[model samples]
Target: MKKFTAHKKRVAITTAALVAIGGGAAFAYWTSTGSGTGSATTGTTVPFTVTSTTATGGPLTPGGPSQVVEFEVTNPSTGVQRLQNVIVTVADEDGILWTDAGGCSYKDYFVSDAVFTAGDVAPNGGKVTGTVTIKMNNLATNQDACKGLAVPLHFSAS
Candidate 1:
């Protein structure tokens, strides 16, 4: 048993307070903020080319023969290209053409402008093919408006 003085008492109290504060800090969560440099790059674009286009039964004779159009497409991408649609259109041609019997083909006709379903084309010199059935007007007599007009065909894919 030693004598407790006011100074000693004060020092003891201060030490106790410091210890309590340190204990509480140990149990508390800490947070810090920092920053760093970063970068984001975009992907490259792929090129598409139409290799060749061919049509069956040229110089189309009305009510004569059913015609067909076939074309080849190429993808120069590094990854596979998924095509959603292939749009076919006739240009520089004559009168209105239809696929029905009284139209171009009595046996076949185009139900839609888009002839292909979803398909994957290989990447890097990869090739894909598509075809469509077409016909000129099938009427009582051949109209001069639908003669050998050298109508061009256009095809595009998504």
Candidate 2:
């Protein structure tokens, strides 16, 4: 009985070794490699320009009506881009009344919504025009502080 059990264990070990060796030999015949070449293309970048039709605005009086500032933007990209929105930054060349000493707040002077839909500028070259209306605060507090103020308006689009 002991001899028979030893013989069975030996047979199992031999069978596993044969299966592993056979699997390895099968993969040995399947071995080859190849190479190829191709070209990679990239998208073209578009050029753009923004011109202020109303470059200089002033001589404005307090409690005045809205001042129309026009802007023309050009999109020269190969891809189509729409006039989604306009962003603007304002600054006074000469120092004006500080916020602590402020008479009229900037929000009071300028219209909150200055951007208008100017439509889409075509790709490869096209133009879109928009307007920003600025108004002066009619408050007496802003009378002296905002006098002869030159606020440079910077514009950007997404």
Candidate 3:
């Protein structure tokens, strides 16, 4: 009976470890402070406007069974501002999506690949802009796709 109890303990410990390893960041966030509101891709109010957006180059590749997306932002904020270090989350009819750290090139990534500082949207927010690239392979590349698939990119502060 003692041996049986020991065996059960080992199994339980192993199972707990597997669950934790599988938890990943999503789990970490949940286990921690849970949910918190943050930034949106598009800034609003009379204070700021994204201004313009342009693609620096063509697709990174043949989509790599996934797509590498890039974003260009123009700051027109009338107040002091800095890029928010965070995770850009997108959810659509397909499901949820995001870029991993490897997909990130910018600094101040408190989570995933979110960049927090490029320039500043100060008393006269900088025309400040930068690029964030993420691979979208989980989505289907079928003939028929969901119309207006919503991608909500969220960010956190450093």
> Evaluated with TM-score, which candidate comes out highest?
1
Cα lDDT over the full model 3: 0.41
**How does each model score on TM-score?**
0.55, 0.53, 0.32
Q: Which model scores highest in lDDT?
A: 2
- Model 3 is weakest, by summed lDDT over 10 consecutive residues, at 103-112
Please give the TM-score that candidate 1 achieves against the real structure: 0.55
lDDT of 3 by residue, 1-158 (tens): 99999999999999999988887535333444567788758644433333223323433222332333344344455656655543344532233353333332212111136433554555554544444554323233331232223223442222
Where in model 1 is the C-alpha error above 4 Å? 1-35, 92-117, 139-142
* CA lDDT, every model vs. true structure: 0.61, 0.64, 0.41
Indicate the residue-level lDDT of 95 in model 1: 23
Q: Clash number for every model?
A: 2, 1, 5
- Taking all chains together, the TM-score of candidate 2 against the true structure is 0.53
How do these models rank on lDDT, best leading?
A: 2, 1, 3
For model 3, how big is the CA root-mean-square deviation?
30.8
